[model samples]
Every structure is written in structure tokens, then in C-alpha cells.
Target: MYNSVSEKDWVEAAHPVSQNVRSDIAGAGCDKPYFEPLIPEERPDIDSPYFVYFGRIHEDKGCKTLIEYFKHFKQKSSNKVKLVLIGKNFMNEVDTSDDIIYTGFISDQKKSFYLQNSIGLIIPSPYESLSMVTLEAMIEGKPVLVNGYCDMLKKHIELSHAGYAYFNKEEFCDSLNKLFTMTEKEKAIMSKNGIAYIEANYNWKVIIDKYKYVIENITKP
Candidate 1:
């Protein structure tokens, strides 16, 4: 079983025998897979608070680039949006500012709170099999800004219309600007679209059904 389409392709290329097996795509489900009942609740103004990057803080994860693009955005725009980093740091060169906060190794409960309140989630990693953090953010009705080099992440953004994908610094800054300037109604629509997409594609019920089908086929005579 593969967690993503890209993973399946990679495995088949590396091991020819993988082609004979019932290779399938079963995406890693969100940590908080179930959506909350939609009730009228006050959410923070989109431009008032911050955007978040929650994952391993390392060079491969593109933490440094994310920080640089965020700084560039803040310097160019009047928007007071902050960037919050939530994970353990493996990168030595990262620095924090009044606009950037590092909350190293937060609890899952705290992580969910940040996801729920943030303007959006930024995943700068250029490589991912499947990003659970991105799905978790969507479950909370938040948009995601992902790196375009990763086909899996790009596919998620395109199929769901849940967020933006950036391939360069200019595109990264542009996406941040666009997300910040969106109207409340537009943000709400994006959020709704993301939640619906996850429910249809990544929810446990859908994943379980896929697994059952694969198992039944393999077990059949």
C-alpha cells in the first residue's frame, strides 16, 4: 500500500515486483479526521492574526525559505500578518523576529488551536508523500499554501481548490498577498471547499472503504 500516487510510482520503478502486487493509494488520514458540526462561531479576522507553518523545522522541509518569503512579504506589504513556526528545529540558521514566533514542539491540542485560529497553513516542503498537517488544517476550515514542486501537494490544492501553490519566491509572496487580501466571504468559501474535499477524499470512511476493496480483491480466489 502506498500513501500517495507518487509513492506508488516510485515503488513500482524501484522494484518491478511491486507492479504485480495490488499496489494502491491509501492516503494518510488527518490526525483529526472528523469535521466538527458547523455552528456559528466567531473566528478571528483573516488579516488580523498570523499564518502558520507546522512541521519539522529543517532545510529539507523548506523552513528557511518559508521564513525568507514571509519576511519579504512583511517588508513589502502593510499587512501586519505574523508567521508562527511550530515544530522542533533542525535548521541552524533560522531566526525569529517580532513578526515571527517559534513555539518549538507544541502539544497536539495546542497545535489544533493554532490551526483553528490562524489565517492559513503554509507548507513549504518540496517533498511530501502525503501531508497530514495540510489535511488537518483543512479539517479546521483553513486554507493551505504549499510548495508547487511537490506533485502530491499540488494535486491536493488543484483538486480541492482549497489553497495556493508556489514554485518561486515571487509566487510565494504573491500568494501570501492574495490570501491576505481575500474578502471574508471568499475565505469562508475556500474553507468550505477544503472541508468538503477532505470529507469526500481523505476521511476515515472513504479510506476504510478503499482498504476493504483492496483486501477483498487480494483475498479472492
Candidate 2:
């Protein structure tokens, strides 16, 4: 995520990415004070529910894997849950069933709205440096199903208790089943936990203060 590798610099972004990096990467990460964006709803057909994904559709993102997983899930599930892909359709060449919605890059407001309305998020990247959408979904008070293979993101998920992660079909199925079984109140509690983690750890103030202290101590006066 660094534009420069030789020397370090600080950034304050409109979203929670900087906040996450700041908290996790020590003094190297810093932020300017900013208010949190308000969460909005934009999910489609919440009654039947759908699994949402936000990113480029490519092999790295495991689009085929997700498509397969959801296909199996729909077959097993009592409800007809759909998989909504909201990004560039880089995987159009890849053979996938008709159930998946290729939304091909939605706006921020539209994405947030989708996030708000989805049952959960599914991100199964084989290798991901950092997933900003993970933090974004958490801020929206939604639980996600992620690829826990990476130590960094897995650690974040473990620490924050924001969501679940699984390697393959069986584990993913189990996790999804568990999620589907959760009562609305239980889901709400998880959402609350995610929001709290974001506020305390991913908010700009908490991140910026740490930067202030580090800069104060490192000056060449």
C-alpha cells in the first residue's frame, strides 16, 4: 500500500484503511482527525438475502472459488441465497453459473448501500496485501467471511472478532451455516463488537495520537 518503499510517509484517507494501518504498523502509520462516515443501507432483496463481494474479479480474488462455494451453498441452504459481485468483471471468461450478479464497479454510496443490505461478505483471495473493504464492512456493522490464510488479516480478524475465515469448501460451509443460524440479536451483538473495534482501533483520533507521540520523540532538535 505504500507508494514509496525507501522512505516512509503518513497518510490520512477518507476511509478506514489508514486507521487500520496506523494502529497495526506502529508510528509509521498516522492519521489526521476525521469524523466517521455514516452507514447507509443499499442491499437488494434482503428477504432472500445474498452474499456480497467487492473487488476486482480475477483469479487472485478466487472468484471461481466463491462462485462454486455459493453454488453449493444455495443447493444446501433452505433459502435461495445469491452471490453479488460488485466490481470489474475480470472473471467473465471464467465459467460460472447464472446465480452470481456481476455488478461491475459500483459507487461508494452504492457499495455501502450494498454492504448494508447483504447477509455477509465473502472474500477468498489467495494472496491479499490488505483488504480495505474488510474494514469498511466492519464499520457498516456487517460480519464477513474472509480468507484467513494471510497472517496479517487473520490476526486483525482474530483480534477484532469481527468475522469468520475458512480455507476451503467445508469450512466455508460450516461458517456460513453458523452465520445463518445466528439470531438477529446475536448478529447485532457481533455488529456492535465490530463497530467498537473500529471506533477504538480504526478511528483517526486514536491512530493520529500515536503518530504525535512518535514524531515528538524522533525530532532532530
Residue 7 deviation, candidate 2, in Å?
17
> Residue pairs in steric clash, candidate 2?
42-113, 87-105
Q: Once model 1 is optimally superposed onto the true structure by TM-score, how far is the C-alpha of residue 214 displaced, in angstroms?
A: 1.6
Candidate number with greatest lDDT: 1
Those runs of model 2 whose alpha carbons end farther than 4 Å from true positions after fitting are: 1-47, 92-98, 219-221
CA lDDT of each prediction against the hidden true structure: 0.83, 0.69
Q: What is the total number of backbone clashes in candidate 1?
A: 0
TM-score, every prediction: 0.85, 0.76
Q: Which whole-number lDDT from 0 to 100 does residue 39 have in model 2?
A: 46
User: lDDT score, residue 191, model 2?
Assistant: 91
Off by over 4 Å in 1: 9-23, 31-48
**Model 1: per-residue lDDT, tens digit, 1-221?**
77776776677779778335566677856645343433345322235588999988998999988888888888888877899898999998668987988889976656766787788999999999889888888888899999999988998899889999999989999998888889999998999999998888788888888988987898764
Residues 118-215, candidate 2, lDDT per residue (tens digit)?
88888888665556677777777888888777544565577678788888788888888877778989899889887786777667676677667667
Q: After superposition, how far is residue 29 of candidate 2 from its true place, in Å?
A: 9.4
